[model samples]
Target: MTSKEKIISFPHMGNYYIAIEFLIKHTLNMKILTPPPITKKTLELGSKYSPDFVCVPFKYNLGNYIEALEKGANFLVQAGGGCRFGYYGEIQEQILRDLGYDFEFISILNAEDMNPFSVYGIFKKLNQKLSFTKFTYYFALTLKIAEIIDKIEEYIRENIGFEVKEGSFEQLQKDFLNRLKTVKGFRDIDKIYKKYNILFRNIEINKPKNPIKVGVVGELYVVMEPFSNYFIEKELAKKGIQITRFITVTYLFKNHPKEKELIKFSGKYLKYAIGADGTDSVARTKQLAEAGYDGVIHVKPFGCTPEVNAMPMLQNISNDYKMPVLYFSFDSQTSETGIKTRLEAFYDMLLMKREKQKWKKVI
Candidate 1:
């Protein structure tokens, strides 16, 4: 550890930084050095330095670390798990070192299972004042806040497309996020969650009672990170499509262990786990198809092995169940215009299919 004050940093993942900043500021009494929001520059920087074949997340995170390092970050903390993500921190650390950037890299659960003591040990190393009691309190509060935020976002995804006023949901969501940054404790988080929940639920939307529901199933990072997927959910919502995404940090912690059931559901199509979220993707796609969703969108980073393996299985599921599935592979080179055009075509096809079915019923 350096004798000077440490500036800590981590890559951005949606609004996760809000909870993370709160935990660090309150528990460790340390100043957080957050990276700037991911942008085209971030992507360009990441792609410039990253291996051509590596996943897009590596490029994005590396870019984040470089930007933070430039901003005087002395310590970099990264949280990753499942498949290749387990090795990202070590690789990124080595890459930065090769580039002559001096920084301490801390990785949480890269390969090992989640253990509170291990995490506490990392914090203790960072700040001697940190203890299990304080860690537990702050960690629990962060978890609650994360869950609440995810739930709020779920509501936003459902209503954002059909908002009576174009930016009604977005404006309120911006206000909620701004308020979130100033929150200090559990009471503040809980109060804000409730306040925004009501506010979002009350926002006027012109959605049909039987709106087209689309299920999004795919690799976790690509699905969770909006910029990674080019904000596909928001784009869909803009087309008056309701999206159901079952993946969240809460689901990752609470239900990931019972993935045996997902495996069972997917076993007929996929005999083995392809690692990461492949099995879950197959099972969720089948579940959504059987549950009568109008369509399904499969998203993943280009060159991701697990999602690539799931593609054929998804095709089989789509054919067997007679469902429409749209696939998008994202990389730094993926053009927004291409994505928008594809999504427009997919939406029109789904709308036509729905109308044809309705006509059949009328006959």
Candidate 2:
């Protein structure tokens, strides 16, 4: 079939879809069928069709697939990972097939299969016209885009809460993403990032000498997908809470430490890799506690075993260092009100704790 006849779609994970879509359109030259931005209906559609015990990411993916298929997507893609996520494509494909959908599914996953060379192989099969040199150039550009996005966002999370003009940081970020949509080459992305880096730093802020800081660590999917976690970072930013989170598309691709490095970084709290992103969660929480952050927030889908395995280590690290830890488990039925209430209380407690520390130094 012609590239135009093969419309491709993948699930959304925050703004990273911009980068994913960039790579696909340039390499495969296929029609991109971006799923509708996720909403309550997407969650409901996914939940109704999903098995009772699967993780929430599975439900969300299933939902995205159904929506895309209904909208004339003949080609769908899902990424595989170390956890139950590795089986997502197989099961989700079967479920959609049984539902009477006609489509082809692809799992773009594997340690050996993610880099430009392997990815080029995957695309070459779909688009015979794709050349090695051209594919590599665009792939590199895509990674650069993802890296710049994460770096700017890290700055935004740290200062968006303190912007003198509300929404200035967010508006600039929106502008940057819009600019990214128009990028044609490496130089284009570099110029856009440099322009925005200065624009972001120029935005005024009223940050305190010692601001309340919190580190967020969690399951990979929930940590990256805002809708799944009910926009937790945005809600916290509203309280002027400077945030730090270690997981991003950038980190997964470029900075994810080796297993040995992660265990060593975790110190006495962990001796082995728990599973998937869980080990990274424990290690990062310890790093945050040692750095004297006010607290750490751990978010995961309900019944995620790897994260469940990391909790005991997290608690021990919390106790030994006297750092507070807030945990959140997400599912289709999770209560938004409860999340807000807990976050409010968590912010309050962090404020009180910071005050107590200040008083101790005074004496």
Candidate 3:
């Protein structure tokens, strides 16, 4: 591959983006292209080209690979899973080749067949020509920033809806991220943490008179990647809707055991794990609805079986709880306009429901 050949990957999750940024910073003469956010169009294009029986995520990623190659990306990176996704790279590679795009593909996996190692190796390779001490120092700093980003994003997801200033959390988050890129050491991380902690903690947030709380649940990728869902959380926050999303890197890596408890929380409603994130999502949505959330948003990649199977059950839960639910299936070509319109309608319905509840309480 030429030194100028670009490596590309789709935004499957937020942490992947952070890891990619770290990798990109270390590689020499290599451009890393992050695919555009998945939308309806992305899904349509993916579905049009992909095998009908393949899962939704496969189609979405396939679309991303094809689109990225068309846009001059000559190298592709696939990372995720010891399950179905572990083998997705080969299938995607073949599909892309059949489509006539020439590219080098890298699969990031560890010896144990778990964890993303190519990501680490890429950074290591980039640091090879430099001082070992300096490389370790910078790599440590980058890892700290990645951890902080995860923590801060979790906080924001849980509380952004209640923020007094509609976009305060997101704006501070952006500032914090920008600051993170400039930090160089442990001292810098501490300073950055303290500064943002105080800034976010001091913001005056009001409890809405009738808060429209919405819980978002679905496949891991679509839930975390803002590009995939078109910034759905931000849109909900702007509408003063309190949002709760159960999936996060922290939950996936550190809290797997707690998932059993969560499954129990879902009661007897959903039995058997569908696949990947399907089981967790169904459980979380049930709990959220029972907890008096005004609405739920279930997002998945187009044609995802586990999520697709959960939809009817979600609708049943919606009907039983009298809560509104919106489903979004994303791919590389998904339409932004349609997503926004559906969200607007969902918000209006939730707001009206809140009003009715308030009136009932007053009576």
In TM-score terms, which candidate is top?
2
Better of 1 and 3 by lDDT: 1
Relative to the unseen true structure, what is the C-alpha lDDT of residue 329 in candidate 1, on a scale of 0 to 100?
Answer: 88
Poorest stretch of ten by lDDT in candidate 2: 1-10
Clashes of 1: 1
Measured by lDDT, the strongest candidate is: 2
Worst 10 residues of 3 by lDDT: 109-118
lDDT of each: 0.86, 0.91, 0.71
Per residue, candidate 1 scores C-alpha lDDT tens digits across 1-363 of 543777888888888888888778876745689999999999999999898888888888989999998998988887676888778777888889999898788887553645567778888887888889989888888788788888998888877888888889888988998898887778998899889999999998888899999999998888988988999998898889999998888778755645577778885887777788888899899989989998899998898888999999999999998899999988899999999999999999999999999999999
Show model 3 residue runs off by greater than 4 Å: 2-12, 23-75, 82-85, 98-103, 109-112, 116-144, 158-170, 183-187, 203-210, 331-335
Q: Model 3, 1-363: lDDT tens per residue? A: 554545655534564465456645654346767776555666676677777766566766777776777677887776555236567778777877888777878666422433334344554553465555555555565556766777777677667877866668777877887777666568988998888988888877876565678899988777876766789998888777777887766566545545466567667767665667777777888889889898899998777777888888788888888988899887555688999999999888887887898799999
lDDT for predicted candidate 1 compared with the true structure: 0.86
In angstroms, the error of model 2 at 279 is 0.9
Tens-digit lDDT string for candidate 2 (2-44): 3348899998888888998999988896799999999988899
Off by over 4 Å in 1: 1-3, 111-113
- Superior candidate under TM-score, 2 versus 3: 2
